[model samples]
Target: MAHDDSVLIESGLQVLKRYASRGETLSYDDLHRELGDPFKGADVAVQVGKLCDDITVQHSKATGLNLMISVLVRDSETGLPGEGFFQLAARLGRLPSTGDADAKRAFVLEQEHRVFMVFRPVKADTSGFAPNH
Candidate 1:
């Protein structure tokens, strides 16, 4: 049987897909506006956080203007498709750990890719690194 989509999955992916299509980032408030009727309940913020947790979306810091959402593709070498929203951490130079269940999953996936790269042997070029004599 086909499983029902999680509430977060449906609404979150909808929001993300819209932004992804636009190819532009949006702040949280603007995102709420775009969401229209779906943005409701006291749990909205919590839901957004969850969305970030799931790696389906991301949230930014309170910029006094608008909280931005990250739709940037992670490193291509990582072999991950371009998706997932994550707020960037200023210090770490990457998305700050959400420290939630979702964050853990993202972390694990990242590490897994790292390990994969480490094990994969580099392809040799016919021309040596030093150059031909």
Candidate 2:
């Protein structure tokens, strides 16, 4: 049976959100595992690609922050095949000023695939959340 696009997208979002909330990055293998067995050989990668685009678009509409989720394919450091990892891009409220250098640095340092909501500009605020990227 063919899986509906909306269902697949929702499932993907839930998975992303779950990991994000925990301040963790999701690898392609991790995502596939969450998807369970393929139904009639459905392409999980294709579905995930679509889901990523949808999430980026949906989150971009929010105020204060322009959030984006990206799927990155990189060569494995172990010399294995290329692997994919998810990352979150966040741009705070407005353009950075001279005094905002520290904040921008902190933001970039904290910009991983983990949930953005839990992230704080100050390092002290991130004491509880350990990033797995």
Candidate 3:
């Protein structure tokens, strides 16, 4: 079965861009409301996880809330550790404040910069819910 919902996919991408641009994070309720769905929590979770696996988005568990999530895009073509350098930093759930030996901060920063390039600037409150790219 082909499990793809263009609406959901675009929404997920926009959500990531929004979070990065605003420097504000999101929880499940935020996504649910944003998605405006008949979508269940598990459905959203599955979609999110699939996006992460597909290198289309990133997801993370928020520090305070187990159900809270942080998401971003992964397949962005911009931002890199120089030419030809690619890291599998897509669909990441969250960035740890510290205590990670994997240098996730640097990776996420790079990914964020790349994602910025993917989506150009728009109006502050405009819903980035379209796949104009």
Q: Relative to the true structure, how large is the alpha-carbon lDDT of every model? A: 0.42, 0.45, 0.43
Model 2 Cα lDDT, one tens digit per residue, 13-116: 66766776555555555655676733324665554444565554454453334544332211224221111222223232332333444554444334443345
Tens-digit lDDT string for candidate 1 (60-90): 2222212223332232343332223333332
TM-score of predicted structure 3: 0.42
Model 1: how far is 120 from its true place, Å? Answer: 30
lDDT of 1: 0.42
Instruction: List runs of model 1 lying over 4 Å from the truth.
Output: 1-5, 37-44, 55-133
> What ranking of all candidate models by TM-score puts the best one first?
2, 3, 1
In the range 5-68, model 3's lDDT, one tens digit per residue, is 6556566656755776665445444554666753665566555445433324222221232111
* Shift of residue 99 alpha carbon in model 3, Å: 12
Clashing pairs in 1: 58-85
Candidate 3 minimal-lDDT segment of 10 residues: 79-88
Model 3 backbone overlap count = 9
Per-candidate alpha-carbon RMSD to the true structure: 14.2, 10.7, 13.4
Model 3: residues >4 Å from true position, as ranges? 41-44, 52-101, 117-133
